[model samples]
Target chain A: EAEVAQSPRYKITEKSQAVAFWCDPISGHATLYWYRQILGQGPELLVQFQDESVVDDSQLPKDRFSAERLKGVDSTLKIQPAELGDSAMYLCASSLDVGGMDEQYFGPGTRLTVT
Target chain B: AQSVSQHNHHVILSEAASLELGCNYSYGGTVNLFWYVQYPGQHLQLLLKYFSGDPLVKGIKGFEAEFIKSKFSFNLRKPSVQWSDTAEYFCAVSPTYNTDKLIFGTGTRLQVFP
Candidate 1:
């Protein structure tokens, strides 16, 4: 089965350091999503991309976080000067299109820990 | 902005036991509902989804969910569960008429004993 691929499954860094996560969605998927999951909580959308264009980033903390999918196939999410509270599971998901009924395949996630 | 609520945080069951997980969303517009499962160390996988149809939808692994429009709810259920069913389940909602961004609820972790 085609699955989303994520690198650096785990990351540990001190507060004020920078961290990055990477994701490669299944081929032919046009919609990509980045989410953060605090322990014991649901995943919250940070950004959404459609064919290399950002569709929604209302919840993204632009001051410290940034994401890009230049080719619309693979993506990268970065957090500069990470804070203690920024520790969470960074998840990547992708789907065929924007319809809500489309199945979004998720990656294994990169667990970030800031001490 | 929309939100999803899952009342159960954790559930423990033995093999052959029935299972039900509650999920509710606060949205006034047309919506799509889904149930996703995550086994330990595995990625999240869609179990079922309800777009528009007869409220009841059946999914893989003997799982099903009912969408109640009036209640703004979609509840997942399984008549007989096995030890392999131990995993975390998440309920999500998307406002079809508005945006396609998926809003998820605090997940429910199921620990099934053999």
Candidate 2:
């Protein structure tokens, strides 16, 4: 089965350091999403993209967090000067389109820990 | 803004025991409901979803959910649970049927003993 792929399944870094995670959505998928899952909490949408253009980023903390999807196929999320509270599981998901009717497929998340 | 509510924080059960998880959404308009499960160290997988027509929806792994419009509830039920069923389940909602955003509830952690 075609699956979304994520890199750096685990990450540990000191506070104030910079970290980045990568994700490659399933082929032909036009909509990509980034979510953050804190321990004991459900995932929250951070950003969403439609064919390389950001559709929604209202919940993303722009101060130090940034995400970009280049060429509309792969995406990268970065956090500069990471904070302890920023530790969480970063999830990537994709669907055929931006329509809510289509099911979204998820990728194994990257677990980030800040010391 | 719409929100999802999952009342059960954690549940423990033995093999062959019945399981039920409560999920409620605070949307008044037509919405989409979904349940996703995440196994230990694994990614979230769709358990089931409800869009329209059927109030009762059947999902994988012998699971089913009933959507009660009056109560604004969509509860997940499993007749018999196994040790392998230990996982965290999340309830999510799309505020509007055609909207692209999804809001998730806190989640429920289930631990099944053998």
Candidate 3:
């Protein structure tokens, strides 16, 4: 089975520091998503991408967060000057296309701990 | 804006017991509903989804859900559960045939005892 790959399964950073997480989606998937999962809460959408082009980012905190998928394959999400409340599990998911009932496959996620 | 709500925050059950988790969504238009499970140290995996034509949808591991449009509810159920079924379950909703953004419920943590 093709699985989504994520790097740095765990990260610990001081407040105001910068952190970056990487994700490589399943092969041939065209749509990718980034989500933030707070403790005891469900995942919230942060950004959506369609083959390297951003489809939606309304919920993304643009002031301190940014994501890119230059090649439409792997993606990177960065948080600059992280705050204590920014500690959460950052998850990445992908689907075959933007339509139909195709289910999104999620990565293991990078757990961030901001001090 | 769409939102999903799950009533139970935590549930405990013994092996061979029946299970049901409540999920409701607030969306006026057509929507797609889904249930996802996250095992310990694992990523979120789809349990099932409801699109169209069927009010009841069956998923992996003997899980099923009923989509009640009038009530805006999609409740998950299983006749018998095992210890391995212990995990965090989430309900999510997205506008029908629209974008890929999904709104998820808080989540229900199920602890099944052996």
Candidate 4:
């Protein structure tokens, strides 16, 4: 089965350090999403992209976090000067299109921990 | 903005026991409902979804959900469960059909004991 790919399944860094995570969506998928899952909480959407163009990033903390999907295929999410509170699981997902009714395929996710 | 509510924070069940997880969404307009499960040290996986059609939707691993439009609820049920079914379950809702943004509930952790 075709699946979304993510790199750096685990990460640990200092509070002031920078970290980045990568994701490659399934082929032919046009919509990609980034989510953060804190312990004991459900995943929350951080950003959404449609064919390389950002559709929504209202929830993203732009001051410290940035995500880009340059070629409308693969994406990268970076956090500069990571904080202890930023520790969580970053999940990437993709679907054929951006629709509420459409099902999404999820990647294994990158677990980030800031000391 | 719409929001999802999961009634149970944690659940414990024995093997072969029936299981039910409550989920409700607060949306007046047409919406889409979904349930996702996450095993230990794994990413979230879609268990089932309800868009249009029958209210009773069946999903993988002997799971099913019933969408009650009037009640604004989509509850997951399993007649018989196994130890492998232990995981964290989340209920999510999308307010419209055009967007992929989803509002997720806190989630319920189910521990199925052998």
DockQ of each: 0.77, 0.77, 0.76, 0.76
Q: Give the C-alpha lDDT of model 1.
A: 0.93
lDDT for A38 (candidate 4): 95
Model 3 misplaced stretches (Cα beyond 4 Å): B97-99
lDDT tens per residue, model 2, B73-111: 999999999999999999999966546788999999999
How do all models score by TM-score? 0.97, 0.96, 0.98, 0.95
Global lDDT of each candidate: 0.93, 0.94, 0.94, 0.93
- Looking at model 2, the pairs that clash are none
Docking quality (DockQ) of candidate 4: 0.76
Instruction: Using DockQ, rank the candidates from best to worst.
Output: 2, 1, 4, 3
Q: What's each prediction's clash count?
A: 0, 0, 0, 0
Name the Cα RMSD for model 2: 1.2
Candidates by TM-score, descending order: 3, 1, 2, 4
- In candidate 1, clashing pairs total 0
State, as a TM-score between 0 and 1, how close model 1 is to the true structure. 0.97
TM (chain A) per model: 0.98, 0.99, 0.98, 0.98
Candidate 3 lDDT: 0.94
Candidate 2 global CA lDDT score: 0.94
The most accurate candidate by DockQ is 2
In model 3, which residue pairs have backbone atoms overlapping below 3 Å? none
Q: What is candidate 2's CA lDDT for residue B66?
A: 96
In terms of TM-score, the best-performing candidate is: 3
Question: How many angstroms is the interface RMSD of candidate 2?
Answer: 1.3
